[model samples]
Target: MLAYRMRHRIQFQRRVQTQDPNTGEIIVSWETVLFSGRLDVPAEVLTGPGRELIAADAQQAETTARINCRWFPVDRLELYTWRILWDGRIFNITSAETDRTARQEWRLRCSDGLTDGQ
Candidate 1:
């Protein structure tokens, strides 16, 4: 990974659990965690919402980003367990690829999309 390009700090989490403070009840389901460290986002693809920001439609927008970070061992099945955390938004890790030749970094495709009424 390029040290200079590692300007953004990102964290990879597999699982997250949230609970209601008052009731002590589980508010969110449990999830696994990846790792955390500085990262380089050389490419960020933002597809427009395609229409005007009216009301509920804005929640259906989609955003994708290409992230590059230091190499880490991850199994194929574990891809479903990884999520990227940055800028207060959680980006799901859709896919992951490693640099076989150099073994230097991992190319990650992430997306932060929402469904209607969400």
Candidate 2:
């Protein structure tokens, strides 16, 4: 892979659930940083009629992004539970894939949960 392609800086976060001792309430938090890396591939915004269809069916706008990182344990990632921060935008990890044999790179597919707004 071209190193120059990984120009966008991105951060991965995982949600953590904690209980308030006194209030007896469950707190949803995402303070855990699973990984901090660069995305060589730029993000692609979904638009036009296809985007409308996705919004109608999924109820949210989805943008696709590919993130590249060095080989790391795949267990560190939890699909659908991890969020990505890039350029002040938040994206949810839709899928992650890597070649077990190569074990040199990680490709992440992400979706920004919005239709028109970033």
Off by over 4 Å in 2: 32-50, 53-60, 76-80, 100-102, 114-118
Q: Please give each candidate's TM-score.
A: 0.61, 0.68
The number of the candidate with the highest lDDT is 1
TM-score of 2: 0.68
Give the alpha-carbon lDDT of every model: 0.60, 0.59
Those runs of model 1 whose alpha carbons end farther than 4 Å from true positions after fitting are 16-59, 115-118
> How many collisions between residues are there in candidate 2?
3
lDDT of 1 by residue, 1-118 (tens): 5587766766666555588889998764434343443342333233223433344654455676777777766675686566766767677777778777637787777777553101
lDDT, candidate 2, 37-104, per-residue tens: 43322322332232433544665545566666555665744545777677777877667777576587
